[model samples]
Target: MEFLNDYLMIIIWAVVLVGTILIEFETSDLVTIWFSVGAIGALIAAASNVNFFGQIAIFIVVSLVLLALTRPLTKRFMDKEVIKTNADRTVGMHGVVVTEIPFDGKGEVKVDSQIWRAFTTQKDPIPVGTRVVILDIVGNKLLVDVLKEDL
Candidate 1:
């Protein structure tokens, strides 16, 4: 009976290790950190012939500590490497106005073979077919100024 219990504990640990790896592959929301701790604790308990209750307690405590310590560290790293989904990468590129820019509002421009939301930095309306330089990116829109050569 005792040998059977130890074998079950080891099997549980193996299952947890496999499940954690699978979950980590499926999503990147930082959910597997605690599972890793539980798996480690189970492995240690199985190797040391620790009781099932002690194994569970150790697993819970170790997982909680690891989760607490890693949560903030993972969050900080993720925050530092935030992905930008804006037109900032398009700055300094040239494009032509696809629509007639209104005197006081926004328009559209074609850059990199793609149409994008754009606006003029200057007060004057930029007519269609005029080349413009991307000056800055504001929100989802591109701030542009007329290219002197295309004027």
Candidate 2:
């Protein structure tokens, strides 16, 4: 009981700091990060032999302050809609035929920075260097059509 009071704050603040930081890493949602920052303030204050009330006050104040200051900024920047995949990006983009494609045979086209296996709907073969648009993706292949230029 006597030993508990002397070291309780230091121990408690250390655990809070480590625990909140672990949760922050797991979540990456900015929810627990403010609490971790607050715990750090308390940890330092407690380690420097601050009183119990002072340690708790610093903990609460720093947590609330950090939360208030950074929540809006974090929401503005980190909460935006995130694109998870680039598969949809390939659609509607223009690419150049890298390998002459027979109507019934597989060929290759260079789109943006990627080379994709390509196929066509026409019976005639598309020559290399012809500009094409990706129409759809089938398995690992890109279904493409020649983009006719304005005369």
Cα-based lDDT at residue 33, candidate 1? 63
User: What digit string (tens of lDDT, one per residue) describes model 1 on residues 1-151?
Assistant: 9888888889988888888978977877777968877788877888799988888888889888888888898877756464676456789999999987776788899999999888875768898888999998887888888887865
Model 1, which residues run further than 4 Å from truth? 80-151
Clashing pairs in 2: none
Q: Write the per-residue lDDT of candidate 2 for residues 51-123, one digit (tens) a residue.
A: 8899989999999999999899998888768555678789899999999989999999999889999999988
Per-model C-alpha lDDT, please? 0.83, 0.88
Whole-model lDDT for model 1 versus the true structure?
0.83
Show model 2 residue runs off by greater than 4 Å: 1-4, 82-151
Superposition TM-score, candidate 1 onto the true structure: 0.52
Alpha-carbon RMSD, candidate 2? 9.9
Q: Evaluated with TM-score, which candidate comes out highest?
A: 1
lDDT of 1 at 110: 95
